[model samples]
Target: MATLDLSAHLKEAKKHGPQARGISDMARSLVGSEILRIAGEVKAFAAQGNKVLDLTVGDFSSKEFPIPQPLEEGIIRALKAGHSNYPPASGVIECREAVRQMFERRLGLGYPVGSVLIAGGARPMIAGIYYALCSPGDKVVYSLPSWNNNHYCTLVGAEKIEVPTRPESQFFPRAEDLAPHLGQARLLCLNSPQNPTGTVIDRDALSQVCELVLAENKRRQQAGSPPLYLMYDQVYWMLTFGGVTHHTPVSLYPEMAAYTIFVDGISKAFASTGLRVGWAVGPTDVIERMSAILTHLGAWAPRPEQIATAELLNNGPAVDSYLAQMNRNLFTRLGKLSGAIEALKGKGWNVDCISPQGAIYLSLKIDLRGKKTAEGKLLRSDEDTRKYLLEEAGIALVPFLCFGLAEDTGWFRASVGAVSLADCDSFQARLTGALEKLS
Candidate 1:
């Protein structure tokens, strides 16, 4: 029998740190699209006429809600004009300039052109910031029941500290909870008009958080620690449904602009998910580093897409008409869904939900342990109810389990964004029927 020298091979493997070991470790720790997978299966079942009334993913259904007409035409023209080559790595100058202008005009914040980088979506923008700012074993703080990608802290070799929020406080992390962690935190992730739960962080809450972040960063610097970084995932920036005033972290704290990275794009507001485009704004150094990283990953976003996007922004009237219609369409659906959830509480389900001020989702609570129908049947976990709803009542919902939640809970997320206002009524009916049947 021949014995191989394993130690020599292991030493050779360790030499490829940044390229192989680091990134591979990052990949392994990151969570994949668990919700999307369930959503896909339900969609397949629906297509097969299984009577699946899916509420699993956040997608806007094609109904009276129309895609922006001008952007579509602009894209066609750009493609026909032969603008198919690789664009500048940072992003096209025109798009970057538009982004800077939008920030100033809309949010009242100013960012220089060199401070922006365009990516496929907010996810890539997040990944770029993590790569640029976090080191192995650094701590990153965020709130729970958040977008599961907060798990990416581990991917960047950073520790994830979750500030568990309460229902009474609207599930937002308070500054007091964050202050203790600031000394060790390398990054903080804030998602406004949050995914799953459509709770928009109130302006006052943001103001308090900004003050805490700055004060704590100053303390940490005095103690000779690295400054804490802030990644604001404002993907639903322009998707406010009700009369809520949207707040930007960068706008709230310009001093923290050096540490703050803002993620935004056209996916939610413009319904352009298939376009695979988004942009980030941060410090010049941070943008430069992330752009280099993106270049190594992919040369650049398609040139035609950038040109088309610029045209859409530069043309005011067409975009305004689209935005107006979209706001009306979204609010109509969200109002219907909120009313449905509120009505369920009277049925002994004891469900509680917050009306979404922005974005498409409304996170609802079902007291699994206490839930009972007038008929006296017990309600179990969200997954069990979801299955019963799908198989028996023809309704589909993404269970809380898919969002990295603990067991024995009665929370689930439904998207009111994709479905039309009329379909949302049907969805509510289907859901009501399922709840009634369970009892």
Candidate 2:
């Protein structure tokens, strides 16, 4: 072969305007998050000096809801004590031990410290699990209107089987819905109290799911195929409201320990998303492989944060107090918005809202489709309804399409993470005006 003329090729390529940048086929096939795109529009609108109640982002506003005081103090102390070095590829020993204890104490699930892998956040842990277990074109099952499962499936080159959850079940997948797909799936991704929908799987439903998974794993083993694994994303487990209890597969059925990998962290429970700490707990072999994958990717959680998190998880009183207060604050905002939407529905507005269930999200339905605006714009799709609400009500919310739902699913997720009680209180009048103007 002739020697490559690298410099000549570079010079010629530069002459043809800006050279086209190349991305992997996988990267090129992925679509960006519509939630973030809507958030960008909200930012631009706010930049014009208009007051907008932005509920698009699933993030805590430090002013409205701060991270646990103990966690914050512990982080400060860790930094002061010179915990700036790199952490173990898996995690600091103390942090892993703390995670072990936390799961055992809180959820009655016992995984050895060796089975826990820490990473920058739940995203990395999730990606690592996908990378570790899934082969190209392997089937991965999840529910639609979920958070990031589709994107993860795309990233791993797995065939996605998105089960459409029904509203009657609070938009959570039933065992029957998922049973049909389990035989062919290598990974089943689940989240509860789910992002976007704020729903939790009922105990009975979850028990059945665990049974199905166990059965599938047995069949796979008999057939000499790789076992199906469940990636349980329970980041919002602690945020369940009212009498709703969060359930995990391993907790209900101990046998699930062999096939379930938990993706959890302080991102939601403690409102520490920016702290960049999360973990995965699973079978030792799977976790070891995931740890190796994450190690090569260099996605370890920060040393100081990990050290601080260890202290915080072990602080029972502080964790309990913070969770109670956080739940109260979140519920107040969700309740207010849900009630306001119900009131509007009573007044003949084509709007409805599910009662706040678990997470800091309220499921809102604004069926403004086929309605004509004052400016003669027809509200056709969920996007149209989203824009109408944003422009006319000065209220920003994320449509279900952002969460991988169909364009016509008139549903939206109003995240209360960044909004305050006062912000929710103001939503009614603005929303009423917007609805009135629509007709």
Candidate 3:
């Protein structure tokens, strides 16, 4: 066999047979969120730069009003007191009670302890709801230009229907707009004081949505169809600006409360996003299902953190102070951003600007076409101009294409929550400089 060298025949063999696919097709179908993708790249770019004002993350960055000092001391106390063990998956009884009471008083709704399921944050709470309530081949409806996480419905194997939400309708989808899908939708996920757009749904509009969803659900049931579920994301419920009170889904059509799962977290309200504490409250059956689902995921939130959160929430002063400070800080910065945007529009750029009633972001549509920069480059889409601004102007913004809007060319989301009033003035100047260069 002339030495029969095995190495000589190594390249002659073909590859192995294909393996079975364990992951769901839905998971594979999802693309990474556009905002996250761009934000990641911009962050990497900024890391190497000498100066970069990172406005990409929407987290608050004010030192004027710190998180309650006593609460921080309490967290340290809990840790030092050796309360750092694993907790009940449903959450500690004390914190759960505090959550229940907070909802009861804040939203004027009564919820027993069994109705709440604590998780890492609003994202998990939302995912748990989808897992517990929605099966594959279900349909989930929402409005367009909504939060990117709204696609979690699709990731959970539900068909996502995005109703058009425009400036004319105050950025809320009309009940009539939902008529076609109401009969078939298994879940409707929504957020108000909505992210990116910051449009609050009025009491009348919210009431109409509740009535329509419930009425359609009843019609489906009478026709032997399964009841639809409503999932409300209320993470920003407390961060309203300009005299807008947060509205809970439970406030409207309490009867449909049986079918709605409300997701709330301490991230936005308390600026404790790093704590990873959030809860979902709803009907007993839903909670029971979520509890079982959470068990498979194991140990609840950190015990000491939960205790600290409960103690802070139990006190009215800390929460009130936090809310007031947040409102004041955001109001001032939003005024600055709005003014800058208006001035840009006055400078002959066609821009679509939404006056934010609440939330931390200002959605902007900057005209990038027919613009030449100092570098002699012609402007194009939002991503193109976003990169130009970040690299040339040291500013970072999330382009709006991540929210599934096709006509969102040249659109971006700028967060004013972290920028101080002084910093905002500087930012406005930098923005105008960039605009002039492009023009």
TM-score for all models, in order of appearance: 0.88, 0.95, 0.89
In model 3, state the lDDT of residue 421: 76
lDDT of 3: 0.77
- Can you write out model 2's per-residue Cα lDDT over 158-211, one digit (the tens) per residue? 999999987788888889999999999999988999888988889998899899
Residue 293 accuracy (lDDT) in model 1:
86
lDDT tens digits, residue span 24-97, model 1: 65566566687877877677778877866566767665555455777778778989998888888899898888
Candidate 2 matches the true fold with a TM-score of 0.95
Which candidate number would show the highest TM-score if scored against the true structure? 2
Candidate 2 has its poorest 10 consecutive residues by lDDT at 14-23
Per-residue lDDT tens digits for candidate 3, residues 93-164, read 888999999998788889889998887777778778888877877777888777865567666777778887
**What are the runs in model 3 whose C-alpha is more than 4 Å off?**
1-27, 62-66
Task: Decide which is better by TM-score, 1 or 3.
Answer: 3
lDDT of 1: 0.76
Off by over 4 Å in 1: 1-31, 62-65, 368-379
* Clash list (residue pairs), candidate 2: none
lDDT of 1 at 44: 79
